[model samples]
Target: MRLKLLAAIGLAATLYSCDDTTTGIGDFVADTDEITASAQTFEATTKTLKYTDLNPNGVFSRTSNAYLGKFTDPDFGTYTTDFITQINCTEDFEFPETMQDIVSTTLELSYSSFFGDSLAPMRVRVDMLNREIDDDGEDLGLYYTSYNPEDFYNKNEEALAEQDYAVRDNSWTKEEIDSIKKANGYYPPLVIDLDKARKAKGEETFSAFLKRKYNEDKKNFKDSYSFIHNVLPGFYVHNTSGEGSILYIGAIWLRMKVSYLIESSSGKVDSLVYTSIPFAATNEVYMSTRLSNSGDNLEKLAAETHNTYLKTPAGLCTEVKLPLKEMYEALGNDTLNSVSMAFTKYKNISENSANNPYKMGTPKNLLLIRKSEVNDFFEQKQNYDSKTSFLGTYSSTTNSYSFSQVNRLISQIFSDMRTKEEPAEGWDEYNTLVLIPVKTETDSQGNTIGLSHDLEVNSAKLVGGEDGEKIKMEVIYTKPKFNK
Candidate 1:
């Protein structure tokens, strides 16, 4: 009996590629059998829900890239981003004993790309942080998208440095940029000079202050902890003036130039050596971004009953409600072979617009997970398990994000129903799922190894809502037919 059952299941598994219809076991088997196979399609209702309350706990987990500047979208409204980061200091770092004078101190913001008008002028301000990011050697727990920088530093105080610049360097020609890139492999960073004693009303320069602190206390330079807490806390980087562009800053570092005497063997000064010492915002320390969204566009879109929307960087997400109990009742005791669903995206017409030229693009990746586990999934830093959670990539050809096989998710839902005291009748919290925009980390072979919340400016309009076209879920299963 066990051999016959195994043979029947093995044959039924091959019918996964068959059309949506019922098939008898005797068709594959030479002899008549008591089992049958079938495939069915069902419409699963999905609705768009607001996903504005995102708390990443720490920004590092979500994205390594930091953002700065402000941009206003016609569809999504205005978004402004600024960041606060702790600079990492080398352990037991010390200045040269023959140091003569501080030449200059500058903050370099290095970026790979930017969104919006590259020629748009913007002023970035760097302020010295007086408060520690961590709460007395513990996690701050206030690292949300809506974090307030005023709580950490006084805005009324004089800023350490500020620079008015554009994202693209217009001074360098295209040929010059190409030649420089070919030779150096990268472009120069936007340097903001911190030693502004001549410009500001202060008596001492910031560089001299740093040198004085280092000389006064050597123990504070022991590690990043002591350095951030005692010596130099951190910096609050914000946009003080201008708009229209947001830079995708990959790394930020503070460089201090010092002129020191290089002595010869005869005890004579040979040359005045000038070099820079850098303190960077590495992964060893904490960094967070404060994101703010203005205007009533999001609220207006969320209330729409037709097409649903998906936005990123503390924006909206779509909610889907699947009829699991209905599927169970329709296909009772069937071995679910494969389950597939697709969310078609509406073609964006605003991309070709002349006025709003720099609109946000659609998110490339989407995460479909149970609504109840959304918080735990991000907080615990869990990957897609394909049971209660799944990852879907957007297809430009089909204009959809399709989950090819979700049989395990269907099986898990059925397993949960079996454990209940009574059969679940209607749609509940367990049947609902959320669609989130995510950033995926893949290996060299293009296999996704890690997942995080995408902190980019993106939006997608999916064709499924209360009054919209219902999403179709295809299910292929095999069930037994008892002999009469």
Candidate 2:
């Protein structure tokens, strides 16, 4: 089936020609009218902006060494794997009253409002507008290198190996001294003492001349002691234009553009800048119904995306990994603290434990339930107990959800997993799988290990024993049917 597009427009053009009867002076010349220069219709249009993978092979560096750099805005943010379908174009294409706001804020901000077609805007506009960088990597090296007397001593040893090439204490040549004086708009207070230079040049001592310059004539030295030699990387982006669409007859044209600043230290995208504009047109124009319908569609699509992502093995793996990294960071450098945190983070069970599938209660423990199973659970509850069946409403124990709530969540997930090739699934019912780490501890070398300790209920038996004991559950109510 062909997917419906959000924007559709048509353009027209015409051409003309004229002929002359020049047989004689009496011959009459004929003139004709013609049309020219019209816009054409496009079946579809799509564009995407992507960052060239800095690590071209998509692999991290092999060197074990690490570096510390200043953090930039939008440098280390989380990527919600869940699909998030949203309406990008809500305002009519009327020229914005405050043009300055366009420059200060993200022009293509995502927002929901009462407007045309009830169609939810595809958040692709936003993701397409921005870039993602995983700055979550923790560098343990930064800790010891900065302080730790032992590390400092070891670094000194490394430096001593190339002592001959190290900075000289007083070995400033006349030319070098002159260059520095000219750079700072002054002559060196005194010429480099030749005897002092010979004695301290290989001794790894700071230059006495440099010290005097810093302590006495600090202002003059500031210009001479610059860090221009520092090696750094950066990413640069330049936006060219915006995407526009005509909503209604004589309606305004909504336009949006994508741009972002770059991180100079690591040469990565720092933040995204979106620019949008609305053209003005006079007409009895209203887009509430259209916006509402779009919103509804987006809600549906988001829900579909959420389930498909969480239920997948890769999604489950990512769900498991994110928390582990966070927990490790929280533990800090203390061995005991790290060990305790590790155990707390990873809890498991024994093979012979009574529980079957294993019960996980952590927020990171993602529960992916089949849509059918969830509906069945609700239907069963409604039959035996007469209570509010709204999916959003929850009981004191089990978190109750409304269809809309679940759909929205799922739809957001779908937006994250945007791909035309991926098949969409229906929410007939829903169920979930929980991940629990039972056994965890640190070894002598400070490495943490985890082991599964127990088992819990399985699919066939919603709640049962480790040996696959089934719950004596029953469903009295059934889904309603509509027919002619």
Candidate 3:
């Protein structure tokens, strides 16, 4: 699944409040029969959003007025922004570059399929933010974090050695430094798993354990975000509702403005500066194509068994992804040249590595768990496994070529068009721009008798201009919101 994240304030609430809070606001004066008559209008409004009604917990309603609701002070409550986006196409082929311009045109058309045929509506949600302030007043963003606080503490022991290294001021002997380096893996853990420890002492919830643990190791809890030099943690959204769900849930992370007070003695945050972790909502459209029955089977398998891709063909199975180069050869036209030109330029600009980020395995017993836990489990397990898809190999490296690298090469066509000039030919006349090879088993007789089979490539069209002259491309680019 392609994941894009965006943040938004409550727009629906604004629309709703405007209707109910006016000076003349009052229950509508209607006859009981008139109210009953309004049901048709209510149902009509909801039918427009038939898909959203899928959530059993949700409600659909209609109202005549829109109103604004009281908001928590931005100073105290939360403030957020939703990223507004549009599909962009910039062509970069100029004069002689027009030879490669076909690639750019092809890319522009293909790009739509990469994300979707249409745009998704925006969405907003409230998330808890964590912040720290020093005694003198300074904001420190998150410096440390852990899936489990206990895991943080375990890691913290290693960080102490690094601190010791700094305190030694290079006075320590090489032998001493080596010993510490061996003992300490890296920095200290930012989140401590107090709950686990407290449980040993008869404590219950992990939240309660944190209070107990923090009090004992208060000295270690100083403003850590300041020392947080390399790593940052960001949230991986499992799923979201409202507009984000219009095209699957847009996954997101936070970028916050924090305030803190530095302690006079320890140089750590002494008072709360106001812990606000605000997210900069951004989104990218997901692009993928389903292969008729096989594709449907793949999706169902994932949903039913909590699996991803095709581990085993469940029901109907059909075509598989054809090779790009082979297909290019089959077309026996300028398609390869166009694709190559785009691929080369895309590499120059995007510097994309041939990695499949979406490849993942079905959880051991995912279907048995509650829906809410599915996201959390995947979040935890994602770090442990290598992603691979039966549709394609895990490594971009194939028996001879890197398909993803080639795709990246193809992506360049679209990228170039976005930044460069559009070709004079335009896209209306190009018809099909991309060609891929699909192989099938063949029964043949070698020496006119012995049996043997050979594979062959075929041409496939990806993009076109008004009359199908221009070509377009598409890609799924994942950018981390904060960090992890």
Candidate 4:
């Protein structure tokens, strides 16, 4: 037997010399030797499932931008988004004592981009909150996308302001828009005047009310907490009328234009200085968005078996049922070398269509994680460990998101199976994984530093499902020649 083993080693070395493709010690050995190497591909079952994370705690702690307006997709139905936010007031905030009067009070919704028809007419309404957002307690504030704004304000009462506008400024000529873009690199915000108070008749204007509050007590402007609780609660902003458009609002600003008298050294009024004080919605204060979806079209799409869909901001996610037990049974005591899986996106056919020209693009980043660990993983803001959790970037050239190697994931799953006294029978449910759309925050060096649920508008159709073509997962492994 010893002589035969030595002969096998010598033969394996000769094989390695002849084949430059030999990768490992097992690869050099023949099937008759002590160790053998081989590769095989398995099909993984996948299907789309409706996703919602409206837990009492929160779905996300914070978001980079707020979504507003309503958009109806040809296949996916109608999506409406609204937000309630507390504007931050600087600590010890105060207006100059020489301030003459309020010129204008405007709520500016600043956005870098929007989805859907630019010319679609939309109406937005803003109302002052009667109660403060509950954020101060043992538990952190709830920041999910399904919050109710009616809890903070009275919908029956008149709103502070409402405006009819479009995603693109129809009032500005092409030349004027180009000039503004040349100077600012972007267009101006959708400004809504809030000077008039519509809540009550014979009452002070919204700007006058702010001035009066500051005059009454300066302590009310001591900090954001005090300001939101005492002086001004916040604002509940929603679309009263709109369709076929959704704006990705980056920031919300409440600007108060003031005309102050500039005095000379002798205390004589010389000139007037017009300026604006801005109170903005920031991370320090609480902000929540409410997302609503309607229509049977979305239901029909989610039930599609030929292809799986991925939609963002409280939409569907593809669930993959990994056959770990089957893999273990096939390769009893083998060592998993590598496992590669890729999800190819279906090209958008509506891109070239004249009727439905505006189509949402696929999510730039995706996360593959175990279904059981998803909530904890996101709640803890954990990054992909490349083991149980992995990240895939979309490749425009190939139109696919591929995970080149997941051998660690396979090894981990197998290790878990070994610890059980008996063969794990009902663990298939826990062995499942989910694919989620994510927005990744990168550093200056282009390294990903943070990950969160993508709140922007995005849709993707992947080629995989139970009744459709199953996703192919290439697995490479080595085992004892006798076992094989």
Cα-based TM-score, every candidate? 0.87, 0.17, 0.17, 0.86
- Among all windows of ten consecutive residues in candidate 1, which has the lowest summed lDDT? 23-32
lDDT of each: 0.75, 0.20, 0.20, 0.76
In the order shown, what is each candidate's alpha-carbon RMSD? 5.5, 32.0, 31.3, 6.0
lDDT of 2 by residue, 240-356 (tens): 121111011111222222233544567765544445433221111111100001123222322331121111111111111112122223221111100100101112222322242
- Write the number of the candidate with greater TM-score, choosing between 1 and 4: 1
lDDT of 4 by residue, 1-484 (tens): 0112236455455434332332232223345446654567777888887775324333563675778899877767788988888899998887876888877789998887788888999999999999987565333345666566777899999888988999889788879877876786556689998865543466678888888887788888889988898888888889998688888888789899998988878889867799989999898887777787764766777788888988876777888887777777776467666677999998862443225778787899999988878777776778886777889999999999988556677676666666675555576644688899898888999988888888778988899887998888876665555443
Model 3 scores a TM of 0.17
Segments of candidate 3 deviating more than 4 angstroms: 1-207, 219-296, 299-484
Query: Among these predicted structures, which one has the highest lDDT?
Result: 4
Q: Estimate, for each residue in 4-35, the C-alpha lDDT of model 1 and write its tens digit.
A: 22454665655545333332212233223554
For 29-94, candidate 3 gives per-residue lDDT tens digits of: 433222110000000000001111122211111111111111111111211111111121112211
Instruction: Count clashes in each candidate, considering only residues at least 3 apart in sequence or on different chains.
Output: 0, 84, 71, 0
Ordering by TM-score? 1, 4, 3, 2
Q: Which window of ten consecutive residues has the lowest lDDT sum in model 4?
A: 19-28
User: Judged by lDDT against the true structure, how good is candidate 4?
Assistant: 0.76
